[model samples]
Target: MLRKSLGALCAVLMCFSGLASAAEVPSEIKIGTLYASSGNYAGVSMAQYSGLKIWVDQKNAEGGVFVKPFNRKIPVQLVAYDDQSNTATAATLYNQLITQDKVDILAADFGSVLTSVAVPIARDHHMLLIDQTGSGATFFSKDNPYIVLTSLPMSSVWPKHVTAFLTREGPKLGIKRVALLYATNDFNGTQAAALRDAIKATNGAVELVYDNGVPTNTTSYTVTINTIAATDPDAVVALGYVNNDIAFLRNLQDSGTRFKWLFTIYPGLETEAVEKNVGAKGLEHVFTYLPSSVMAYKPEFGLSLSEFRAAWDARFPDGKVEFGFNSVAGYTTGLVLEKALAATDSLDQLALRKAIVGLSGKLKTIDGTFELDEATGAQIGETQPLGQIELDEHGHLRFVTVYPPELATGKPVYPAP
Candidate 1:
């Protein structure tokens, strides 16, 4: 009789413990992020912010996302701020997200320049930064596991295809002399260094005639174009952001000084923005990184490219934010969070990091295969392939994947006529 009484007591205690665990689950998951409303990074920043919103809204509509620890769905609450494109402002806001709002998830802004400020802050606070598009090489180190790059590969890895084409295919196309021009920022600076090292490793197979770095804010490039023209380089590689590319291309067009081959970053990444500022004729025959916004990658998780694009249009009919690579990046960040939450054992920051790391090579999204360097949390998959822009018969712009034969959609048109 005493034994039976003890068993009943134990059952009651277990039931209460289970109830306590369930009660500990928070009512909502707070996701904190920042966006630039007005500045050089404004266009891409807003696009990314809109993409994240799409995910949050979609999940809430379906009765919230599943949390494994609680074994139940919990609604997401987004806590966001505008940094106005200032790094100092971003630093303060990042701290506020952790200490003040106490967000469960902390995400950075659009690109490297903005994301740079959040890296150390997140680390100092022991929060995992969901880096959306900042791909600077310096940002990732073995010592810091407090960050993860979700959308783009590291900046140093970005020029892999570009270097291959320059060293191997470039010689075949009669491209000997090359000129390198880039914005002096973390994003373009690292790429310039990588490209320089790759070209130099060729041992005179290719030569850099005029290599220069200009301030990121410099809009006028007529003098720079003239300088590069004097070098008579067969190819001119201009690495910069949307504004820099637009100004450089416009200057090149106005000066009527054309290199045999020209390459720029934004023509494909921010297609609509670049195309709108620089006409079809300006971007024609330009080489760029073929963005996932145009190239469809079969995803194992989340919405497909076409489906996400349709949803973006429906939500943003006014077209204030352009749908491009950054837009896809923002949504990709949300997908990572969703998967992490579903697999995490608890809400502890380190637990969330472990859950995300476990998803490294397995999670394939619209952005491409989501793989990470386990030590540094830097993205290693979803590489950017080389592509060239060509105007169709209708004068509409189209991308032709040229390099990396396995994924090549069409041959490259060397020596722009």
Candidate 2:
């Protein structure tokens, strides 16, 4: 069984490889990571980290990365530590990655809070931070030269498409009162700020009634839901991760509080695990952001959306650890590093950073374009399309892209019944 599983993933996809003509590529490159290996978000983090490992393993299997300067190929090594879902521990571990472990490369954990810990350390050490997941808006404001997002869009632009859809469609449905609920962290904080600004621009067509940011670990939503309910919001927009989305939806069901329209962030709708957890009835008519795997996904890097999905299914056929496009996001991180390392032909932190920023707009991968406005180290490559969960003609629940007509797979269902 193990042999069969390993052989299935050897799908002849192109490895991001090129010869570096300058510094000698060592026998192996050490990539260090700090993620929640045993906490609330540990499972999600583990799956995300696996994306990076997938790419590294593939490269090693292909006889490592060739470096013309060294006249040899160098394999990659991953040195990961369990942050235990603590931000403070992540910070300390990052310092260890830089000093004690002395890793040549650093990979971010899973979300905004954990990734934020590495931004300062990378900048201070002048090492390139190949951000795999974090996309908080504030992180890009400082002109940080050491970090760049690989998978998700900058938080500043995350709410743009969804908010635009609401502004244009809300008045038609009498959705005057809208509530924004988010996790009280950098990722969701920035999302709430953006949503507020987007709604403000609608010129009173949609009223921003209840806006709240709750803790990331808080499962009970009675107090917040009550406040939200009092406003009688027509639509409730939530910015949460997998756990937050699950808890919020379940609590909303238990409280018997149903909104005409529902939207949440990163609900894991693309993964069946989330569907099984929330159940089809609980998830019916919920709207959220759909960046990929929603019918608008474009082919890039070495794989298309469908092809990538097949690859993931093949690798983890047990259905125990399936991830959405984020697995591709992690793989894209490795692609960026490979591009920069080859361009600079050196692993020296400063040199790699310069190489990466210079390759802005030049890099393209499975996630989308990799362009960064040098002025703000934020990636403005891809845009998301709003999606809603609805029953298809077959009467089976499925997430359909609704907004941005060009990429939409189906029309938006208002007052979801």
Candidate 3:
């Protein structure tokens, strides 16, 4: 009887210990994604969120990221917060995610203005902050140790491509005069400086005839439009987000101002906005600078462009997969974070930061193979292609590669004459 009782006690103890161990398994790893889904940047932000969800869904299907140290996998749960396109709201969301939600890691918001606030807040809390969308060179300053810039800064590709295009074709087109416009925001300010630098580099006699930076909430663009029209420049380069770009274009249409070339910035090159707002007729024969993703390049990434496009469209059918660079950007960011965790085996901020900084050495991302630049600590990628836009028979914007004969999908159309 005594032997039997001892054996029963041992068995019970083993059962209890096993239960305890199972309970210790982490249920989930929390991550926070901040984006403006309701306000100004809603179009692009919504697309970004959709792309992120696809990655999250797939990862969860695979039982989430494997935490090597624990020898277990933990599902990733995103605590998404909408900033409503306000910087203050974004800052508050960052605080709440870090202090209350206690997410394992934090992602910088979709725009530079939003990231400007979130970056400092993450730095204050000593958390790892990966920049997913915001790409002003100013954000890549050496001061912010907690912040990591994963995308190619607007400065990196914007100026160089513009300069190269102009150097080869400026005199041919008689595009000597230039007008510049930018949004009164951090990202645009950084880009304006880069644009000026590009103009100087070309030494092609381009004049900054009309330079204006309008407030974010500027509703009426009549004055700005008239001023740009008065300049009568050969080329007009206006740098703004989607809304600002649309408004400026509408005002330009109202004012009946047409230029040889209009280099609108960033998301304007997106097919959705071009179709809905600019219209096929409105955007016809316009040249814009978009990221390399739209122009096509094969750099030996583990994944192909077609795979990325198919995955994106399958997830968000209503969303525009045309210029899915930002979506790819967000997805690439999530993958990089996963790889970093796998390599470091820890979610500790410092360990993750080190892993991120060391990413350039070993990782191959979908955007292209890139490593961190020692000078700016930003991931530098390949050059972007210059693409022109035209309307199809259905009034949809068709992006055609027009520069660098090697990647030319079609010939360049200048002056639209």
Cα lDDT listed for each candidate: 0.93, 0.76, 0.71
Worst 10 residues of 2 by lDDT: 12-21
Ordered by TM-score, highest first, the candidates read: 1, 2, 3
Better of 2 and 3 by TM-score: 2
Candidate 3 lDDT score relative to the true structure: 0.71
Judging by lDDT against the true structure, name the best candidate.
1
Q: For residues 251-343, could you state the per-residue lDDT of candidate 2 as single tens digits?
A: 888888778898887553345546667777788888877755444355455566677677677888886676665676777777777776667
Model 2 score (lDDT): 0.76
Number of clashing pairs per prediction, in order: 0, 0, 0
Q: Using Cα atoms with residue i matched to residue i, what is each candidate's TM-score against the true structure?
A: 0.97, 0.88, 0.85
Superposition error at 281 for model 2 (Å): 1.9
